[model samples]
Target chain A: MDLLTNILGAIATIILAFVVGMSYGGIVRKITARVHNRLGPPWYQNFIDAYKLFGKTTAIHHGWMQIMGPAFLMVSSVVTLMFVPVLNNGGWFTNLNFKGDLIFLLYLMVFGPLGMALGAGQTGNPNSAIGVTRGLSQMVGFEIPWVMALVALMIQFNTTTITGLMDVQQMSGTWLMFSSPFAFIAAVLAMLGMFRYSPFDIVGAPTELASGPVSENGGKFLFTMMSSGSIFSFVKLTLYVDLFMGGADNLIILLIKTFSIYMIPVLYGIVSPRYRTEQAIRFFWGWPLFFGILAILYAAIF
Target chain B: MINDKNSQKIVDIIQNWARKHSIWVLAYGTGCGAIEIPPTMTSRYDAERLGVRGAATPRQADVLLVTGYLTTKTLKRVIRVYEQMQDPKFVIGFGSCTINGGMYYDSYNTIKLLDKYLPVDVYINGCMPRPEAVLAGFGKLQEIIAEGRANGAQKYKDNLEWYKANQKKIIPSLLTTDYNW
Candidate 1:
């Protein structure tokens, strides 16, 4: 009975995350349109788009791996969400949140892109190959500082579990953003690349590479990628909130915290021009890397 | 292969509704009328409000907007792009050029009739259709989609032989694959 209940709880959490993620994506579109001085589609436009994709009668596939790509991406996003505590306290929203799962979360996050890369490679499109290469290279560049920041936090709080870190913040009445400003700054900068917006969106340079890795993906395949992308965006924002902004105790607080973090990348994307792959690599390794080191040093000292 | 007519009709209604609301237009510009696209997409017209956003690749696109006249050379590429697009795709022939070759009517290189080469779901007849006319064409497309009258993809598939024969007359060295699938 307990096992069944737990499974149901997990499913509920996944559904909630998917719905909220897509909604946030829609809101972002509306916000972007307003910024451009144009009225956008309805906030539920993404829902209609996804539904239409599923309803599409015509679909083409390259191979088994191509089919597995979006599946892997969706799984990774949901799995990462599962490890993070939804509410600051505990309830139906409280995911598995097992001890030492931070490392697992990090690995699962990267697994999505690696799976996508394998799929993109088989498409026989030169654009897909180029996009995958840039994506993977950018991954390497950003992961260094991102991991460093995570490591610093883990060391400072003496906990590898996300819930443990949240507890430390709550008990001390100080968010990680305030306590470890260096790590916060490093992580935020790394997030610019992670979000894959402008400046670091070399992977999916639509103008240059025709939407990059998913160049050959269409209909249901593209739909799956889109949903997984939204879910992953939510997971990333939630993780940032839990680590830096202090985990929210309720739904409203969670939305407030996550949406603000979400804006950092979305707003930045509107104004900035894209960077080349090499330029992006150098950017991450420069100031962000320096900030990561400073964060580690600060953690070690105090 | 939905055996039940009523169930199939119901499915189509829902599909049509979703399809009409989310027409992802491929950003492939084949001619001079491409100049008007930027304004339509931007704040002045904002076609995105109607869910007619530009797609980067043929794979993900729902609507292929063939702007202005298609030379035989460009026609081959357009046909290839059309074939590459997934099912339930659409073609919108923009400007009088696509209908009757407009200013290029006397040109030896331009194809006189686009429908002979590929199935066109919508045709916006104008010298160079203004952005408003382009949007109106899209609105017509949405109506056709909602009424489930847009069967151009299926038409192309069913009449592939005739289409290919017509295509070969112009581009004798057809470089695209058979596209039988």
Candidate 2:
């Protein structure tokens, strides 16, 4: 009975994450359109797009790896979601959060892109290979500060679990965003690269690289990758909320918190031009890296 | 009774509705009509609100918009792109040139009729159709999709030999691989 209940809870959490993530994507599109002084498609446009892609008649694959690329992405996103604590108090919303899951998550978060790179390498498209290289390079660039910020937080709270961090925030009546301001700043800056919005979106550079790694993918393959992207974005936002803000107790609060966090990247993307690959790497390693070092010093001293 | 046929029909309707609302157009700018596309996509016209958006590549595209005249050289590339696209795809012939070669009617190399080489589902007519006409063409396409009448890809498949014969008459050295799908 317990096993069945746990399985059911995991399924429920996946569904919730998918729905929230997809809706947030649609809202971001609407906001982007509004910024451009144009009326956008309805907020449910992404649902239509995903469904249409799902319903497409033909899906072409270059090889076994091409087929597995999207599968790898789906696994990574869903697995990442499993480790994130969706609600503050333990309930059906919480999946597999455990001690030291933060460090595990740091590795798991990057596993998808690496797996995708291997798959894309098999496609034989020069653009795909180029995209994979840029993507992995940018990953190296962002991971440093992201890790440093997390390390600072872990040291300050003296716990390596997300749930423990949330507990500390609750007990002290202060969010980590206020307590470790430098770490929060560094993490938020790292997130801009993680989200791959404007100024950091050269990896996919649609106009230049033909949409980068997934240039050859279409139909069901594209559908799978698109949903995985949506779910992964939700996982990242929820993780930030859990770490920096107090974890939410219910669905509404969760939405409010996640949406607020999401607007940072979305609004920034709207007004900015894209950075080249090296420029993006340089941008992350500059001020964000400095903030990460400052965060570590602050945590150690205080 | 929700028998197999009825259930299949129900699924078809839902799928068609979803497909109608999301049109990813791959614009093949073969001639001067390509200039009009910018205004159509940007804030002035905003075709995105109508569910007509640009796709970066042929694989991800639902509709192939052939903007303006297609010379024999460009037609070869167009055929290759169209073939690269997945099934249930569409070809839209944009501008008067595509309808009957417009001013290129007297040109030796320009293909006079588009449907002879590839099945065209919709054609927006003008010297260069304005963005409003382009949106109207998309609206017409949406209607056709909703009615289950847009089957250009199927048509091309059924009469592949005839289309190939017409194509070979213009370009003797057509080098695309066989139609796998």
Candidate 3:
């Protein structure tokens, strides 16, 4: 029974990952279109693309580098999956909950982009080189505020396991969104920056950089990236939802909270112009990061 | 022996031929021309009724719509993307850029004619073409697909170097001091 349960869970996880990714992608596309006052592609548009890419031929830059790209993508998303809890209980991998700490899960988040950069760097393509450089730039810009926000949250909750944070809301009947609003807002902004949606899309701007690091990856590798990116986004969003709006016995409220948060950035993405790397750096380093750190100190005192 | 096998093959062919009309488009919204492609595709103009919807990747898209001017830099990447798509693909040359360079006619970076570099079916003309014109082009391409002459993917594979030479007419480097992707 345990073995059968594991098989079913793994299969279910993969399917959810696929749908979650497509849903995340759909929302991004639809919201950007709405922001522009235009009708975007339908919600399942991302799923269609994934299906389409899988059917197409794969282009391996150096052939060998293909292994690293998908492996890292799969690994990083899998790590996120392990840390994330479902239904107020430890998710499928309870062992991860036992052995891994908050630091481990956070470290896993850093692995993905680095792996992508290394894989692209080996391709020796100039456009991809520029893309990897911008990804690094984006990482450098957002990391400070993201860290500050996490630090603040840690001080407020006084625990590291993501479950503890979620459980805090469940036990206290107050979501962090209302609890440490500043840290919550900062965390939201930092995550959006990490996603590099609009303006901050300096690294992979179609008009400027042209798909950036993923430019060279085609066929199976592109498929893997799409699937992993889609799934991981869902994982990330779920983590956010779990962090902010727990204890909703009614699923509608939870769905509404998740969808609304996703919509906020998506709407902004539509009407916005891609930011020059300099603008992004300024946005991250200036007031946002400063205020985020201030929130941590405030949380510590209170 | 030939009659029995041929008739069975013909039956299989008819079923497959009926499937191509629902051609998904992978619209590479490259430039200004992409403006018109989607409007022609949505409920207002209703491309779904015509069996064409914009797809995110080149793989699922049977029709690759090059909506506007292909910058020399973009064309190289375009070729790479085009090559990645599966067989039985159709390249819809939409707008003046894909047809004859549109507003970028003299721009050193733009490809004056996409056909010189890539095989194009159904040239739909307009500097910034209307949604109706895009649908008309889609209709024309679908007709070609139905007739089985629109599959350009196989031609590309058969003579890769011959086609790469077709793009040699483009001196993309002349447009920039140092060519950058």
**Which of candidates 1 and 3 is the stronger one according to lDDT?**
1
State model 2's lDDT: 0.91
Per-model TM-score, in order, reads 0.97, 0.98, 0.76
lDDT of 1 by residue, A1-302 (tens): 88888888888888878899999988988988999999988899999999988876546768888888888888888788788778787744665778888888888889999999998888889999999999999999999999999999988888999889988999999999999999999999999999998888899998899999999999888888988998888889889998999899888899999999999999999888899899999999999999999999999999
For candidate 2, the per-residue lDDT at A101 reads 98
- Candidate 1 residue-wise lDDT at A218: 90
Name the regions of candidate 2 deviating beyond 4 angstroms: B1-3
Better by TM-score, candidate 3 or 2? 2
RMSD of each: 1.6, 1.2, 6.6
Name the regions of candidate 3 deviating beyond 4 angstroms.
A90-95, A247-254, B1-88, B93-118, B125-131, B139-149, B158-181
Please give the distance, in angstroms, between residue A282's alpha carbon in candidate 1 and its true position after superposition.
1.7
DockQ-superior candidate, 2 or 3: 2
Which pairs in model 2 have colliding backbones?
A: none
- The docking quality of candidate 2, as DockQ, is 0.84
The sequence of per-residue lDDT tens digits that candidate 2 reaches over residues B1-181 is 6668989899989999998999999999879999999999989999989888888889899999999999999999999999889867988999998999899999998988899999999999999799999999999999999999999999998999999999999999996466566
Regions more than 4 Å wrong, model 1? B1-3, B175-181
Candidate closest to the true structure, highest lDDT: 2
Q: Please compute DockQ, using alpha carbons, for every candidate against the native two-chain complex.
A: 0.82, 0.84, 0.15
Q: Which one wins on TM-score?
A: 2
